[model samples]
Target: MTEKPVLDSRAKVIIAACEMIGENPASTLSVRTVAARAGVSMGSLRHHFPTQRALRDAVLRTIYDVATSDDEVIYDRSVAPRERLVHCLRQILAPQVGDEARRAWTTVFDAFIATEPTDETRAAYLTMAAEGTRRMEHWLTVLDEEGALVPGDVRQHANFLNAVVNGVSIERALPTETSVLERETATLYQAVDAVLRAVDQ
Candidate 1:
């Protein structure tokens, strides 16, 4: 029989925070909530994470790791660069579609927009946004190394792509007379083509 894996206090705390964030990205990860969730004492949680920011950052790092754990396609040179890049961008937008997207936006509005946000709330939201921009930059850098991207600042390109994706994601959550998938695809390719060099180039 296989032995059960062991998790220390720190790991358990992080896991608990990640689960809370997964359930509601905008939810406040208070020490009390996480400690109860992790089945650890408040002292044990504080011993590992000290401050709310520390806990929040640790949880986000774990999430980033999990999200990129299967990102082999980011470096796969076999696929055409434009196609590969578009596919990667689509993954960012995929989660922001349909009723789920509407719910997500509603949560964000309720948490951060509808009222004044606390320092912790503001910091958490900004950190999440910064993490997203970094991921886009990582993808663009790979294409740049392959000589498949236009000559430009990687950050600028990443920001532009991120902005386009954000706009499309917001649109996806709104009511529309027709399905926007095709339009979204066209818009993504247009953004990709602007940054990526032609295949023959």
Candidate 2:
């Protein structure tokens, strides 16, 4: 019979931090809170993760790993490159729609915007934003390799796409009389086509 692997103190701390992030993406992860949640002493938690930034990075990395492990659509070549890229980018904005988006924005306001910003809070927000940009860059890199994208800076293109998605997401959270999804699709297509080669477009 196969034996289950035992989790060490460090693993436990990471698991606890991941759970906290999963519960509230915008919540500040204080060392004291994560230590208590992990059932470890502050000394132990700090031993594994020297700083709050360290802990935050580990948790974010873990979340990214789990989230992207099964992302096969990015590699599926049967779909046309433009359509595939659009589909991949749409996944980023898929969750930010309607009432759920409103609640998420409310959480963001309470956690990062409304409150007096601390260094820790500012670092956390920046880390999350960087991760979002990194994900976009990865998608763009894949499309570029497929010879679908026009010659340009991959990072710049990713940042532009990220900004566009963020703007559309925030708009979706607000009161809108028009068809938000339709507009969102049109916006995504425009953003994708802007970076694609004429043949690919």
Candidate 3:
């Protein structure tokens, strides 16, 4: 006899949260709703994530995982270093997200901003942002060690790059005409190229 498939509580909650974000970000996400959507008991959800902050952090991490999977493809050492860097920058600017996915992420961001300030949510969000910046710094350090980066402060370079990326993301969320979209899209490549030229020897 075949055994029943075992579901992971954490994964179930993350998936359910993602779905809810897309469906109705304006609505408060409750434990009951997430548990029901995941087909798991509230106890099961809490077993994995003891608090709502923990659950939100998990959801954000899952989103980052999905966004950055293309990093694997660009990590091939056989490729030229400059080419790889360009590819990585492009990937960061243009995450492989469809229209619906884009809207879902925007919705989450909107709700997060609109909600009254809370210590837990703010802390979780700041931690994620810091981690992302650290990842950028790590990449820059790698390039520096490879003798690709110009002799300068790697941390500062990473900060600049991170800021540009964040700007691009904010631009993407705003509604715009096709002509504006075309101009801003070109700026993505230009920004990447400028940063690389400044850093690359």
Candidate 4:
């Protein structure tokens, strides 16, 4: 496939809108604000995304892309599965996990879910999520064949791991009793390990 453009004109407007929304989560993201920030005319913005929902959907798709994209740098892959898993855990448990990044990223998603979302939005997000699940399943299948995983249906095992990772990430993102960065990730860590062990056994 050809390389993706840095950002299409429509995408630029959507990103600008997202930035505005980020400034104040409660602010209603209107097309005029986005057009000004994108340096595009309202007509131009509308040319690409004819309606408000169309623009919103575009922004949400961008969010899903950013969230699931292989943006993280993992230089070392020489380690065993368990050790590699630990590295992945640390990557996810980093301070930024539940920080502004998470909140800002989830804000649009929360809005999308507030009322009944369109079939398009659900498809976009769910497809992205399924991509993550597929990756997890691939990793687990490889490890299991290498005798790194405990045993059983590697696909199901991977799905379970995916569930734990997603749930913990969501929980950490909430306005919890304590901060995820300062407090220990021990409980969540143990919970993940236990689930993995169950898959092995």
Candidate 5:
């Protein structure tokens, strides 16, 4: 029997959208551009996503899956708990895991702030935030189960870590003297170290 293909045309379009966002987050995303990038026709893109909102939501969902997928984490029991925790947290900051989720976030936020924020747009923001929180909480829960977490609320710790990591991204967004990549990498390591120190009993 023949095996099935991994990504269908619709999925290809979605991936193209993500790559486009990564390439130029501020560019106005048009179906024609995305379809061309995916090597599909505009009709094919519309068949998959009838509206721009649907296409954007699909990209967000894909990003969430990429960032939160368990496969991203190393499951080696031999690795120390703190080491594993840092590795898992670093996945959130790396784009290779999903083309730098920060860019996708910036694109979404730009859309929200650049235009009149509507209830629907606000809802999308909340949905993405919840997904991120849930992913962070999962990693923290794993650490807590392994007895690596200190005496504190796991949810709060997750939120704190998320806040700090996002702060790094925010600061990097502004014009600065230092190289953004250098600053981002250094800040990511420091943030992870700080979180592990606080959480490791």
Candidate 6:
């Protein structure tokens, strides 16, 4: 039988590079920088990613994985769809009484917007966004089948709600008063709740 290759090493490099990029995307990222953080040599980094563009793209993909993941949550099917939807939106926002989490999210997201990469990178970003939206849509569909949303275009609404949640994080990055944060948070939750109710009704 063929031997299993060392998969974990390359993954470690990507994960570390991703965290670094998450910390700061607008700053110039060098292979040496990522390698040093990953505890791998520049040659090792180059071995996985031949070009800076490729490495950056990989980092983008990894960034998506690091953020907005369902992996950390324990999904309980016993929960109602409406409840599940609310929980998911809350997780996506990941807001605290203070805005530290939202600020961190803004840093990574701004970097994603600034990073110049290949067509594949752009496509990958779009694809990941679509996938998250689709997950919401899937949840909506289930609710509908179970006779739970008002029902029109579930996917469109899901995307809209996801955009709303994303915008809330981006907006929180701005220097704003606590009142503003409160207004934005309420708006986000209301928008999500509205879609859920509309689709189910």
Q: Please report, as a residue range, the 10-residue window in candidate 5 with the lowest summed lDDT.
A: 95-104
Q: Residue-wise lDDT of candidate 1 within 17-131, one digit each (tens)?
A: 9988877979779999999999999999989888888888778877876765556887877878888888888777765568888887888888889999988789889878788
Candidate No. with top TM-score: 1
Lowest lDDT 10-mer window, candidate 1? 62-71
Comparing 3 and 6 by TM-score, which wins? 3
Q: Please write out the lDDT profile of model 3 over residues 22-126, one tens digit for every residue.
A: 476443457788999999999999998898767766776665556565665445667655666655666665652346446746665765686775665566556
TM-score of each: 0.87, 0.85, 0.66, 0.52, 0.60, 0.58
lDDT (CA) per prediction? 0.85, 0.83, 0.66, 0.61, 0.69, 0.65
lDDT of 2 by residue, 87-170 (tens): 777777665568888887788888888989888788999988888778878878888899888899999999888889888878
TM-score of 6: 0.58
Tens digits of per-residue lDDT for model 4 on 119-140?
A: 6556545554565665566556
Candidate 6 overall Cα lDDT vs. reference? Answer: 0.65
Candidate 4, superposed: residue stretches over 4 Å from native: 1-80, 92-95, 98-102, 105-112, 177-184, 195-201
Best by lDDT: 1
Which stretches of model 3 miss by more than 4 angstroms?
1-6, 21-32, 95-116, 150-155, 173-186, 189-201
Better of 4 and 5 by TM-score: 5
Per-residue error (Å), model 6, residue 111 = 5.4
lDDT of model 5, residue 42: 90
Clashes of each: 0, 0, 0, 1, 1, 8
Location of the lowest summed lDDT over 10 successive residues in candidate 4? 68-77
TM-score of 3: 0.66
Candidate achieving higher TM-score, 1 or 3 = 1
Clashing pairs in 5: 95-100
